[model samples]
Target: MSAGQSSGRYEAVIVGAGFGGIGAAIQLKRMGYENFVVLDREDDLGGTWHVNHYPGLAVDVPTTTYSYFFEPNPNWSRLFSTGTEIKQYAAHVADKYDVRRHMRFNTSVEGAQWDEDAKLWRVALAGGETITTRYLITATGFLSQPHTPDIPGIGDFAGRIIHTADWDDDYDPTGRRIAVIGTGATAVQLIPELAKTAAELTVYQRTPIWVVPKIDFRISERVKRLFRRVPLTQRLVRLITDALYEFFVYVGLHHRQLVYRRLNIAASDLAKIHRFLSVRDPELRRKLTPDYDFGCKRPTFSNDYYRVFTKPHVHLQTSGIEHIEADAIVANDGTRTPIDTLVLATGFDLWEANFPAIEVIGRNGRNLGKWWRDTRFQAYQGMTIPEFPNYLSLASPFAFLGLNFFNTMEYQMRHMDRLFGELKRRGATTFEVTEEANKRYRDRMSELGARSVWAVGNCAGSRSYYFDPTGEATLLRPMSTRAALKEASRFPLTDYQFS
Candidate 1:
């Protein structure tokens, strides 16, 4: 019953104590199932929030709709909560649901193999410990692992080098010359914060991102009191926010020209803000504009990202990076710029097969990595795979909903709850997705993705992580949130084979 005590076998073992793992534990406990353990590598929960401690990290989605549907928090300080507040919310949920007692922190899964004779999963952990379980749920999210590009002579950098994901708490950048590479989501939030302190800040942008204005403000105490008094008011607000975000799905994934025209007009307004209000220089304004259509890649929301460029000490460089030296960066045009500190914001490895970051051996010694590489990534409803019995992947291919990830996690958890309930009803010990069913789902996904903007848009040069190397958009579901919720709620169990 204690943490990390491996004397007896478990009914289920959920990996990575993020929102997904905690949500799964809470759901299982609520269903009167308690023989499970949640394992996390870190000493605490909040997978991404526990790791990323950057200067100005915040969620882009509104806090009103970013929480679990069952348990809503009426005490959000801002419209978009900061990273620290989000992590605190995760902790609060874990404690409130009594899920923290079942968590084994500082325990990492090295590999997982299916034992054919025992019909159980043999999960190897760090420190040479092993645990056996009837079911394995992987909650290791897509954004947990940080991806750093291989630049020439990167190791030869003489100053402090940091990636946005692995920021150092002791290192201070005040009055220091800082160079930031890759202007992605993390960079857009942290750059403005860094610009306030750094003596001279230089940003190396590979491609322009479409950043709209962020309408963030504090929720007053009176509003919070009203939300606490009448919970339905908050619920209605969340519903409206969710509906507005789903409208973006229609504009981005489906080529709705009318909605696109309206979005273009909004984008034109943003362009005026950029050219007239933010930057006065002509060349700088041109470099800031994106050539591709909106939603080709992930759209960012920020109010000060463009305004930071107008500062006298800040510089934006769009030239290709050639290499790195001891204390400077070399551009493709042979221009050398000196820097005291380096920061790499080069996003995560979302599309690769090496994501689970561990060896997973399925039936017939089939490696999950090799199988994905050979046949491409395919999953049945983004939860179960073809050959991996008694295994479920949270937020896998076609599982991510762009509106908000918390909704996606809740949907997957609900689907898994049904699967487990069905298994209990049928008295089955194992389950695997049928190959035919997985293929049909994958074909449908490909067909829908082909018409999505990420597949056919002019975002090839944007270095977006939306698509894989084979030009397939494997990240997002090309359906509305309501449609995805309905499907997850009542999918047929005939697609799975149980024993």
Candidate 2:
């Protein structure tokens, strides 16, 4: 170990160096928090953006709006940013703000215990190091954990199996027969990209998803140069584009007529695409048809996924995989698809299920896992847990998910900065959101969510991560940015008696 590595404790400890973690660190630092440490298991930051580097893994959100409002990128080379580009942008932002000095890379946290006696948190790392802090911030996002399907005989399969989150850097899939399981956003983006290199590709599907065209293109050097030369152009573009997408989210999240029409327009456009695109029989087209209302499942955009099925080299397996036998996958229809590679685009763990693995003991010896379990894994504002005192979550329970993740993270971090400053000023050892304050916020938000397209929409047979296993649609926030701001504005810190 280097001499004087500084085992000194900080005022706060943040887990995961994703968008939320880095943004929170910056906010805290801006608020004059020099003692806090941002700990990440990965050698680098970027959260999901860092790990999932599979082929064609990119942000579907437009480049203009999919970043921090505080730190806009004028040099986005394309309409939709690729995973690598996003990572580069994140690294740039971190460097520009001098936030890397506060980060501890490759230091996985085992668990944290809230030291009630000292009014501090004792952080346990994978190594023998332990650090204590008065506060904890969890920015480990919704997509941090990969969900691998627990198929029997999966381990026995001779072929290489890779989760989208854990793509092998050295492994190449060129000219190999590959089987891709699941058809979410990840699947749609990856399948098309893999088609170029793979000799043959078979996409397994249990349920079909709704995908529209992604109007993506590379911005010319002249445009980017112009943007850099005139900063207002980027600002103006960002403002206009941000407002445009926010409307789509607004209707989808809130109960506005515009969202309904947009949903209809979405369905009509997709249904029309399938009508001309599917050269296969009517049964195949119908099987490919989605049962749920548009926007029920996370909406995807792909210009090539449907077109890839038209490829003679690529085949779409409409039937579900029954089991893995020897070196092949046997489907429910008694057909076997042989492949040398298996890729799971099976999405993430948004159920807040990873809480138990990391012990976060809060007030009165209460663990976060137990509290979440006892309370049905719900968060008050999708931020603070009752017994956790000064600790806050990034994704929380139900904050809206978006590519503009850093924007939300910075916003929440700033809010937290205000609260922490208040705590310091009052010289209070225990400062928590009153239980009444928490419940009231949730109740009102639930009412607002019910009116939106997310809850009471015409969804039928679509199964998605957006809906929990029970089919209750409560994951993403149903409120728009304007609505969220209003809701956030309602919950002033002074409403809760901090002591």
Candidate 3:
């Protein structure tokens, strides 16, 4: 396991074991490439699902749209499936596709460097092992890294501290005082569960989130049988869900100012109505309401999130935390609240910490993270970068499509198919996006993003994770899912240079 010694070589090295990695492995196998391997830092296959087992964790999107279009699960327990079911689905797909054999769990990749003369990538692992591969596809998800607040005295806290990402399943909250920080999507799901058991619960809110009614219900056995009997029935449901998802993304978020601002307003009005109905206290509802547009940040669905605050034992603290003591959290207004357990529901550091998730030194000594920070974050069609030859970053800017990640994964799988097919047809060993093509695509994305709510709408007060440090919405592509799929297949092959 020396630094200079290579553990092995492969045709491709995928740096994740999540759904993205599983999909990539299946595509590679389908393309007659069996020498690829999938690596993950976690001990299990599911990425987010394996890392997060917090109470009340479930899919915000419907089950119909959240799964792979190719491998539909007919037995989803509910419209919004639980995290456990999603994890099981991941295992099923990996096993059914025979991709699990290619995965190496508890394997952390520290960095990767493209060897120009060798025309391959040298990936460094945490245990001092190197892996050489012709193509490097990083499927490290956007939410891989959790963001713990750098609040003073956090280290000195004597009480049990838990991050939702690193939740301890053994810990119970009964009869214990708890303080939860953050009000994001994860917090929206977790706060209600904590309110049920904790003797006293206090929520530290930095920013309010838009919460709508989650139309979740248990799927009947008859529906499951029908879905299994007729797969096309699920496809039709998927189509309808996808259409609704596209409409929301296009009208409510991407085209807020360009086509219809009223749609976004109507969405906000719906959230307000849901809030008004859920929480009877006007002041609590006011504190829970978001000040920005509906799509400024990602929204979540919950039936009891708003009602949790109305309980007498649950308190909502709007004043930001000053610092944490050993047994208490002090507010900015000099108010202190003592709690036995501290829960950090703060979300991930997307642009700052997790864009690449590992060091990538590409051709000509180009540092991917530093270059992105110096310039703007740009990737050609959100897959290939100009300087990074033989590389595909699945979580790259503009790669995400609509609300469902399956849409992004589906299109990226197609993109890989087309790109690799061209590589095989040309008998080339390496492929890098042309600089002109990358720039053209980046320009087009910027142009489209100018019309998005993140760019033009009132998002300053939102503290949206969608906006990067450069104040740009570099996460999601501003195009429809159909367009993304079409472009993935039909994009000019000349966009990349093969050698």
Candidate 4:
């Protein structure tokens, strides 16, 4: 259908139905802005929680801290809730706030181009449908796209090969030789569970991850009842958890020397101690040990990850992959290991920045992807770019707090509300961050990135998704969540051009 014939123009078009999108929708509704629609590529509302259904899939962060401040759930069964619970939480929030009505599921946005003359955005859809909007909010998260490495004979494999993101629940691995590639966050959680069922499990490790103890436990019925009865009790717990997580950010990303260094040292010592105690053989311990600093890459929390290595049926392969044979994976040393199932836990593609899964053309018909590629991926607080007027992106480069995404979404949605409120108050048709303002923010991020562990030290050798193709740390914001919220709250609207 034609751009004007498909659907009437909307005030705002949210390009996701994930946590960020739902949060944005709720905020818009609260702000008395109902002329918005959230379009999702998937048939369901939940984003990460909807797609990932691998075995042993659970949140690393505590349930209290990982949830939205405005919409807290008092019925969490565990400290670290499973993926299903998180998905249910997302659905609950969506239903409670009446966000589902405004959502168009199974509708993928192909591309978006700014109409300079009309002062509107023309959005193309996958099914030759189009829609127009005054404001475009790209809420597509970083973890939406899965990345599987292109190994030789990958397509020629006789056995079933599945990515963690696309796991089949019916495909039982019992009595099957399974080879799991990439030992990231997903691998750490799934390995322990897979070890219990698989006849033989081989973990292909490219790099060792720093795994700390996961202090997870079931929330007693009494505690749940208390939380439900006394809301302040739960709020206090969330506050404490937030503070602890913020401290982690301060030490790991910001300070890194004074108290942070000491904490890191202590953590490193504990990890070493844990490794020493967990792995019986010294060689195996050494192989499992991470040479880089604790916070160089994303730190995982798992009590059973190391314990699984002691199993007789489980094997850790440190040898680099040469290629994937028809029915086996060939090692760099010419050793071939046969496997029935190949599970790739390689994680998502974070560097692509391909939100909306489309080419976004802004002012002067300049492509957003090309502009980002040429000038390095950047945005004003990872929200607005210079040329992309009336465009705001959530879960973009330099926006992530590296801790709780729910907190980030809350802060970002608040910031958006303020921006939209100001636009309405000023009777502005469009708004965009000034080049000077964007440059200053970009410079500050670069300065902070230089001091981060991902940019220096042993992290140089660590193959982390935090760094983009240009070798710049563009994924995470090197700032505390509180600091980020304060900055977003207090940033001058004068830095933005309202027209």
Candidate 5:
């Protein structure tokens, strides 16, 4: 990686060292590809876990379900592991599996060019380093980029402004008025934690989410010992959780009404729980209740969330913020509340994670942005983009069930691994998905999207980030898990021409 001179050869180059990237690195290293690098912008492992250190940050899914299946952890202290615990888990996986040494920390892949004749990927790094590899694998996760909401008076604010992705530990919230904007997953967990410290807390809402209780409990020391002793037990537990959560996709594929009913019941149960858990304010309850179906956006889970509204210092603002004035949030209803600090819990810039700003020129000087834009950034089974040979998205479009992202990540990785194996067997490097296959794949997705909850989720005329503007569903796979496997297996990859 010295200057502009590319070593002009590598078996593969991976971008991002998150779970997917680490997983790919493990597979490739085991496959005996030594001349490779796992590039990450951050100077560390644990992609999302390395970045988001907000208060009370933890996985909503059970610990067993959240972890990687290839190497399961037997000694989790809690059922729902905290952010710190999860990050440590990622570190352990990297160290134990011996994948950490292959990583290029504090480095980012600016763009990639496909060398048609040489069948190598010319990848340019953030600085002046350029690495050439026969194959390129991208694991930059879909949710890794934080999209801070554009608020007025942001620069004018004298007090410290914080984003959930970039948490400021130096600015203490203790005995201060804190305003949290965006009631997404990040806000849900953070609000309760903030309440414990802030003298007064105000939660701004554009749309309230339908959240179920996040059931959590500590795993006994004896259980950990047992898991360590009998490693098979941990795998058995993971299999069970994977199956249980996988059913959320199953229902979406087959029995839609029942799943919808269950989602509704869970939402209704929240109100009853709030009766005993939250503040006894009628307007607050009304504001929190979502008119949309449960699965519209990502559903949040937490036992303490509803109870947070009951805190004496907490206030729920449903009128939506009109604008941000200096040291205050102005609501649309003309209500102004003075606050010292503002926290943006708004979700990440998921759609534009892959070089939304940079221009990528492929072979024939085909602009990657123009190609994706013309084709709507749709992929074949949400894996490979046409014209971008040796390029694959760790992106899960229709495949994103919002229940278990890791499950889809594993599936997508398996497909990628197979593709690489084929490349090695044939001694072919340059590759691009056929336009016919991509069109069929996108068409199939549209039909599946038509019947899924993403299409049916009644959102009071509001739209979730899950759906694209065209009204065609962009998230949540249409078929069952079994069907997805079948489709994945159909990728004999002969449709891809190896130049």
Candidate 6:
């Protein structure tokens, strides 16, 4: 159906078709509410999976822990499933839960504003259409917008330029000389693949990333059958994986100064060891080794990422790209290398173009992005804002829990159920979090954040995306996943104003 032709009110409107939006829709259905719509600008349902199909794309987190806690996929091809499998899983879940019927593909939302008189939200779409709904939920994932770096003479480059997020399917790099910029997680997965084919591969690195060995293996049919026959077995595996992930992220990363600073040191040493075994050259290994502490920026898992650098044809250029000539990139120290193709592995724009991902105006002309920037980026429990009544931002600051996004989605689903249950019980049309409650939660998070590695560790040169413009590491919440779930379910009802 054409989205622009449909203009009407809904009980609720969900502004994403990703896993978060699917989970929220499931929660709403479980609450016996069906009058809603899921909207995505893309033509497909899976958000990142649909947008990103670059070579060697797979989940960094283990597949056992990355799935929804309530719904487990018994037949995973690998321990770390490919992007295609994740997208299939998303479609399966949406179909099984019957939420696909309520989704509108190829729909772009421009902005949303609160209607004070009607106590509803007026959502503006790209094609001059308005959708009014009692509740507005923005599940636009954190990494929604692709960020193209503003390097000098980028537009004048005569070589073919490709961003990993928007990979060209027909383009072949078998015999071409290629240059890749930005060595983030995506590059870790892709560089090895490019090295196998490219005649000459150059990687321009600004900061070295900590890459650990991935213990990924194909799942046997016997194990798959066992998981299918006994769902409890899968649940137990998920529990164990979740525990290990939580421990590494919570204790190893966040509590580096307190108990077991050796854990972080050991992890760093392991990465160094991994690099030493792969790249025998002392200078190359030194250039690959990170100077900052581990977990300042998120670490990736890959066995081949380091080994790829050892190849004769592959060159690691530490002198950053100065500018792009028509067919080559010049280094800052006046070294220029010609290339036929340029690949940008630069990641998403999290703060500026993302966060809200669109313009959002609340009661009394309060803009969400402007407010967050002028003051500080804070969300009450990472879901609700003080002035945004009946609004839920799924990817807000302090919302992402653990390394696995499924953990975040699970707790947020619970939060949604509990919050909406109160609204139904009170017969309220609108609900907004109290300013006092928001402040208290923000203060508590700030206190916890002080002990994190990003705060106390050496991160000046890290250039981590975790740090916002205020120089605060406000992306991941400082608390453990268990605490986040507990708080989500048991937060005081008085924290919100129901009317």
For this target, which candidate reaches the highest lDDT against the unseen true structure?
6
Global CA lDDT of candidate 4, please?
A: 0.86
Residue 447 in candidate 4, Cα distance off native in Å: 2.0
Q: Sort by lDDT, best first: what order?
A: 6, 3, 4, 1, 2, 5
How do all models score by TM-score?
0.96, 0.93, 0.98, 0.97, 0.92, 0.98
As a TM-score, model 1 comes out at 0.96
Q: Give the runs in model 1 whose Cα sits over 4 Å from its true position.
A: 2-8, 256-258, 261-276
Q: Looking at candidate 2, what is the lDDT of residue 70?
A: 77
Check candidate 4 and list the clashing pairs: none
* lDDT of each residue in 184-263, candidate 2, tens digit only: 88898989888998998988887788777778999899989888899888889888887877766665445637657676
Per-residue accuracy of model 3 over 148-195 as CA lDDT, tens digit each: 899999999999999999999999999999999999999999999989
Evaluation by TM-score, superior candidate among 2 and 3 = 3
Full-model lDDT for every candidate = 0.84, 0.76, 0.91, 0.86, 0.75, 0.91
Candidates 5 and 6, the one with greater TM-score: 6
Q: What would the per-residue lDDT of candidate 4 be over residues 394-477, giving only the tens digit for each residue?
A: 867788888689878877987887888898899887899999999999999999877776765467657888787888878788
Off by over 4 Å in 3: 1-7, 257-259
lDDT for model 6, on a 0 to 1 scale? 0.91
Candidate 5 residue pairs that clash: 214-302, 214-303, 279-310, 398-476, 398-477
lDDT value, residue 487 of candidate 5 = 62
Error of 5 at 379 (Å): 1.2
Query: Tens digit of lDDT per residue, candidate 5, span 400-480?
Result: 545666777666766766777777789876678888888888887877676666665565444577665455567566666
Which residue runs of candidate 6 sit more than 4 Å off their true CA positions? 1-7
How accurate locally is residue 88 in candidate 6, as Cα lDDT from 0 to 100?
96
lDDT of 1 by residue, 1-499 (tens): 5455646589888998989888888887877777889999998999998999899999999999899998899999999999999999999999999989889988889999999889999999989989899889898887877888888988888998899889998888899899999898899999999999899899999888888888999999999999999999999999999888877666645654566657756765775575556777878888988877667678788889998999999999888789999999998878798999999988887766334567789899988877877888777787788879999888577878885888888788788778888888999988998999999999998887777777666766766777766777787778777777788878888988989
